[model samples]
Target: MSNIELNDKKIQILEVAEKLFSEKGFDGTSIRDISKMAKINIAMVSYYFGSKERLLEALILYKTSDLKLQIESLLHENLEPLDKVNKLVEIYINRINCNRGIYRILHFELTSKKREENLAAFAELKKGNLKSLETIIREGQSKGIFRTDVVIPLITPTILGTFFHFHMNKPFFQELLHLNTETLYNDYIKNSLTKHIQQTIKALLVYEN
Candidate 1:
C-alpha cells in the first residue's frame, strides 16, 4: 500500500481502538477486538501497533499530538500572561468537548488501581500542560501582575478538573442550563464555560495586595 493508505489504515485502527477502549476499558479490550471492529485481520493491528500496550501508547501519542503542538505554539505567542491563560482555557474546553472518548479512556487509565504503569504516559501529558501554565504564572508574577503565592500544583488540577467535569457530565449540564440543542450547548461550552474558567483562573492568579 501507498504511504497515504498506510497512514489512513493506522488511523482507522487507532480510532476504533479509542472507541472500544472508552466503552470497554483498556484491560477489557484486546487486539483481536480492535481488528474485528476495524474489519481488518489481527495481523494488521499487530503490524501497526505491535501489541495492546503499544496500541494504547500509539493512541495516546496520536490523540494528543495536535494538542501538544497547540500548547507549544501558544507559549511562543506575543500575548500577555492573562491573555495566554484565557486562551489556554478556551483550548482546554474546546479540545475536551471534541475528544471526550480519548479523554475518558485516559482518565479511566489514570485512576485505575490495576494499571499503575500507564501513569507515566498520562503524567507526561499533564506535566507538559502544567509546565505551560507555570510559565504564564511565572511571567505574570515577575511582572508584578500576578500573586507571588500562587499554588501552581493546585491551580493546574483546578482548571483541568473543572473543565473535565463539565464535559463529562455534559448531558446533565445541558439540561440544567436549558441548552437543549447540541449547537446551543456547544456555544455555551466555547463561550460561557470558557469565560467562566478564565475568570476563575484570573481570580486565582491576579495580584490583589
Candidate 2:
C-alpha cells in the first residue's frame, strides 16, 4: 500500500516501530513494546499489520516510497547524466540524514538471523535503485561522457558503502575529528561527506586511462 493510503494510526505504529527497532533491533523489540510506546493496544497493531514481519516491511516501504518517486522524477528530467548522478547523491544523503533510524533498522535486520527473509523487500528496492543507476551510467557511456569500462557494480558499492561506513562510524569519527556537537557532525555529513561521495562517483564514472 502507498504511504498516503496508510491511516494515521498505522503511521503512528510504523513510526514507533521504526524507532524501537532501530534502538532495540527487530528481534529485541516486541509487539507489546511497540504498543506501549505508541500508546495503542497490541491488537490494533496486529489488526493493521497482521505480523511483526509485515509491520517491518510496511515501515520500510513507507520510508522508501518517497525516495523511489524522487528517483523516478530525477531520471525523467532533462539533465546531463553526471548532473543526475550528483542530484541522486544529494537525494540519497538527504534521505539518510532524515531517516537515520530507518537506516539503522535496515542495517540491523540485514545482519540478524532472519536477515534473508526480513530484507527480501529491501533487497528488491535496492536492486531497482541499482538498475536505475546503471541506466544512468550506460546513458553517460553512450554519450561518451562516462568511461566505457566503468563497472556499475563497483561504482554502486563505492558510493553506498562510503555513506554507510561514515554513518556506522559516527561516534568514532566524531571523537577523532573533535566534532563537539551533533549539529557539526550532521553538517559534515550533509556538506563534506556528500560532496566527497558525489566527487568519488563522478571521478569513477569519468576517469580515463
Candidate 3:
C-alpha cells in the first residue's frame, strides 16, 4: 500500500516498528514492544496488522512505495542512458544513506532464517526493482548505447553490493580515509561514491571488446 493510504495509526506503528526492528532484530522485537512504543493497545497492533510478519511486510511496502515510483519515472525519462544511470545511482545512494538502519533490518531478514514467511514481500520488491533496471538496460541496448553482451542479472547486485559494502564498513572506511566529520563523510558518499557507482555501471553497460 502507498504512504497516502496509510492512516495515522498505521504510520505510527510502522515508525515504531522500523526503529525497534533496526535496534532489535525482527525476531527480537515483539508486537507488544511496538504497541508500547507507539503508545497504543496491543489489540490495536493486532487490529492493524494480524502478526509481526505481516507488520514487517507492511513496513517494506511503505518504505519501497516511493522508490518504485522513482524508478518508473526514471525509466520513462527522455534522458540519455548514462544520464539515467547516474540519476539512478544518486537515488540509490541517497535512499540507502538516509535509511541505513531500516536497510540493516532488511539485510538481516533476507540473510537470516528468522522470518521466512515475511520474505516473499521483500523478494517481490527486489524483483520488481531488478525488472525496472533490466528494462532500462534493454532500452539502452536497443539504442546501441549499451553493450549487448552484459549479463543482466549481475548488474543490479553489483551496484547494490558496492553501495551496501561501503555502508557496512563505514567505520573502517572512515578510519582508513581519515574522515573526521559526518558532513565530510556524507559529502564523499554523495559525490565520490555516487560518481564511482555511475562510472562502474556505465563501464559495464558500454564497454566494448
lDDT string for model 1 (132-198, tens) is 8888889988998999988888876676788778877888998899989999988988888888888
| Per-prediction TM-score to the true structure, in the order listed | 0.89, 0.91, 0.91
* Candidate 3 Cα RMSD (Å): 2.0
Candidate 2 off by > 4 Å: 1-4, 111-114
Best-fitting candidate, measured by lDDT? 2
Task: For candidate 3, write residues 1-209 as lDDT tens digits.
Answer: 22336889999999999999988888789999999999999998998888887888888888876787898899989998778878988888888788777788787554777565556877877888888888888888999889999898887778778988987798998898887789989998999988998889888989556
RMSD of 2: 2.0
> Global lDDT for candidate 1?
0.81
Q: What are the lDDT figures for the candidates, one per model?
A: 0.81, 0.85, 0.83
lDDT preference between candidates 1 and 2, better one: 2
lDDT of 1 at 16: 95
What C-alpha lDDT, on a 0 to 100 scale, does residue 203 get in candidate 1? Answer: 93
Tens-digit lDDT track of model 2 for 78-193 = 99999999998999889978998887677655556657565577788888888888888899999989998887878766866798888788889999888879999989888999
